[model samples]
Target: MPQSPPTISPTFRLATQIEAILYLKGQPLSLDAIADCAGCDRETAEDALIELMDDYAHRDSALEVVEMPSGYSLQLRSSFQNLIQNLVPAELGTGALRTLAAIALKNPLLQTELIELRGSSAYQQVQELVELGLVRKRRQAEGRSFWLEVTEKFHQYFEVDELSLILAQSPKHNGTAAITEEE
Candidate 1:
């Protein structure tokens, strides 16, 4: 009989696959998606996720697995946030930057007001920001309009308080008060 290579256990294989999927996606992934990608059942996927989470937790690694409302994601631990942020350059474009600045300056801003202030392009900017995990949109109580607010991720990524100080000191915003303040 010919010699054969040893086989990997399903649990180990599924755990490896799930880790790769989460790493590549860079976002939360539902259990169903993990199972589909790993070619395993839901129970297997859930087990793999738990295994991965525990593995990361026990290790002294800077990264961790987190469960969000949307799904599960692999990310740097809060303690490592500043260190990683310093290494990665910001990826926001000019339009997105402007939109974010506007929102950060006047958070809980109504979508209507944003559109009026930043033009129709604000819609696309908002979408991009949301995808980047920097902004969140919620339906307004009174109308079909949405309320735009910066998310915790935004604060983590940009250190909003620092940005706010910079913006306040900027000549452009020095004399200009927040739109909400005017009303």
Candidate 2:
């Protein structure tokens, strides 16, 4: 017998929306991307996004589904960005910042790769970035390669969509953090 693909259930639709809101924020997302992640059809993913958009609109949320050069991203309504900026103190320092830039640029790269490029200190840098919620680590196959990627917070700090700048700024991942004055 030919195997059939699993269908998207009502519960699955809701879950997919939640994951979309969490992962796709400040980024473009294609229906196919969402469908791939949700393990459902593109039509189903589109339907779920439409439904989620309506739900947010009805609630008059501080966030919204926005179309960007990349695709669809859940972004903070312009009115709220300033308010958020005020909460994060300027004294946080740059160890986290440099680390953030490195991960944002070489995303999905292994921790060891980062360390090798930047040296042993890179581990401490990654640790600090992870602590600040600016970066995340995922264990991959082949002896737990740590996958490094940026968090939503990283997006808000630079006010940019593409992460290419970080790479151009620092190709070798040096664990040494940079110190900068308040902007």
Candidate 3:
């Protein structure tokens, strides 16, 4: 008899399907979006995402399924990003860069609060940032967790006394973080 493809569980198959969608999109995607693209229901998409998360968590793979502020994504594992460091530009990825920008915009931000805002994945970003000398992490004296601030190196690296000025001028920012620059 023609060998029937080893009957993969439906959930596993769905997760694999969603993985492909995430890979092709090259960005975070909501469960609903994944459902629509995969022609599956939202619940199934969510379950698939969960399954994918577990699959990646267990497999010895260099990629991961991470839930971002926007949605779920399949991307390079942060731990592996540095392995291929010599091949890529010596710069943080977009997600980490965004996290750094957020810290700069809100300097002296509490690490807990930053994680709450950016999600747990930010922990890795903060670590990378501290290693890069762009951010400083120090434990709070009180019972609270660590506090994060932009290092002096941040200003020199970005070449600005105030990053807010640069962000405010960006039309995409909608001027929400805008602060008046003294003439």
Candidate 4:
């Protein structure tokens, strides 16, 4: 006889699991997709989804799970919008953002290739990015071309680390309190 798939945990509803998966994937998933994943009917899945939504209705969090007409997705919560905006240096303008976006999307791209893709202004923008410590230059032995990589600081600012590992590294109130106690 064929073995059945393992049962899902009851601690959090199937929809909550779906939400966690969506957040980790950083993309939206349809009801059918979520139901298929959670091994439940659409109605039960949606009911669980509603309950999960209620759980996240109003509280401070970096991200929130939301359901759109097409699918469900996890996104940065609006309350932390300012925090995100502050993370990036104000000196970096739209041109810099576009340049960074291009570089990040096509990482390890050559400086010449980036210039060709982003135009002549990219050279100056790249220099600026280098000064800002957002991008680094790496030599590509294949063609002796230099490529840019995002720095650890950039990752911290973005809270990427698969889930705010940056925040985890920072000194928290409890940590400071312990230090004071030792003193």
Best by lDDT: 1
Ranking by lDDT: 1, 3, 4, 2
Candidate 2: list runs displaced more than 4 Å: 1-12, 15-21, 24-26, 89-96, 99-183
Model 4 ranges off by over 4 Å: 1-7, 58-62, 88-183
Q: How would you encode candidate 4's per-residue C-alpha lDDT over 53-172 as one tens digit per residue?
A: 776777566777787787988877777779765774545689988998677655556898888788999989988888877789988878877978777766676556532333335565
TM-score comparison, 1 vs 2, better candidate: 1
lDDT tens digits, residues 1-183, model 1?
954423445555667778988998888999987777677789988998999999998999998999999999999899977875568745788998999988987877898999999999999999989987899999998899999999998888776555556757776655336545654
The candidate 3 region of ten consecutive residues with least summed lDDT is 174-183
Could you tell me the lDDT of residue 122 within candidate 4? 94
Ranking by TM-score: 1, 4, 3, 2
Better of 3 and 4 by lDDT: 3
Provide the lDDT at 7 for model 2: 50
lDDT of 3: 0.81
Residue 55 displacement (Å), model 4? 1.5
Model 2 agreement with the true structure over 1-183: per-residue lDDT tens digits: 955434545554554554554464435777776666566777877777878778777876888776677777777788888976578533344755665655665566688777766678778878877776667788876786788888776677667666555534665633223311110
Please count the clashing residue pairs in each candidate, in the order shown. 0, 3, 0, 0
Per-candidate TM vs. native? Answer: 0.48, 0.41, 0.44, 0.45
Highest-scoring model, TM-score = 1
Give stretches of model 3 more than 4 Å off.
1-89, 164-183
